[model samples]
Target: MNAISSYLGSDHTRCDDFFIQAETNVSNGAWEQAEVSLAQFTEALERHFTMEEKVMFPEFEQATGSSAGPTAVMRMEHQQLRSIVALMRDALAARDAESYLGHSETLNTMMQQHNMKEESILYLMADRVLSGRQEEIISAMTSIDAPA
Candidate 1:
């Protein structure tokens, strides 16, 4: 089994792949494909966020006893990401490739920074502080219900 950083970092990569696929579809002027790809990307991203918010962050905070630290900042960042996602969705619905690309650029930058912090610091801390419970935590994260 992978460590928390490995597991969640892999997820970050997965979501990035989906985002890139959507962006490529948009750049190709394939609006139909872009819509489908964007939907997939949005769903995957939402699931990742839910896994963190409902399972990983809570468990990390419980183990570390630091509610207002990294997890809090992460939660706030999640909200920001979600807002951008909403705008992207609107752009997709309107078939506005330019607007979608703009939002995608913003999301890409934000995700890169957010993921660096999580992978380098927060996830590493969780790996150490919640060492013995790694399996339990990872199991919970994997089994979390995807957001509807």
Candidate 2:
């Protein structure tokens, strides 16, 4: 609504909220609730990543003509995050609390660093380069056809 940074950062917060709910449930040994929360978190997080990979990142890259730049780094980080998510999912399925906690800690740390880069640098860059096309970008991001 306010631009790329506000819109995407708010989504980051939303995903974080879902992560927190799942983490809390896991900590409480509430497997059922944790499963539900984690599923929601994974879905939302994947959606956010898809929006960036499919729409926002390409738009930013084309506008700036910097393929091997911040977007590339972000893409790499997304893959790493996805791998970590898979590990977490495995841990959840196995009911391995220790593994889940360890992976979750790694995830939290990675997300903090990754998000700082985006919210501070990449999003600002997008907002600057892709100026006036914010609404279209947001619409694409929100669209069902944007990505998974």
Best by TM-score: 1
* Predicted model with the maximum lDDT: 2
lDDT of 2 at 22: 91
Q: Score every model by TM-score.
A: 0.97, 0.96
Candidate 2 on 1-148: residue-level lDDT in tens?
Answer: 5699999999999999999999999999999999999999999898999989999999998998889999999999999999999999999999998999999999999999999999999999999999999999999998834234
Q: lDDT (CA) for every model shown?
A: 0.92, 0.93
Instruction: List the candidate 2 regions with Cα displacement exceeding 4 Å.
Output: 145-148
State the TM-score for model 1: 0.97
- Give me the displacement of residue 28 in model 2, in angstroms: 0.4
Q: Score candidate 1 by lDDT.
A: 0.92
Which 10 successive residues of model 2 have the least lDDT summed?
139-148
Candidate 2 TM-score, true structure as reference: 0.96
* Candidate 1 lDDT over residue span 16-132, tens digit each: 998999999988989899888888888899999998999899999998788999999999999999999999889888988899999999999999999999999999998998898
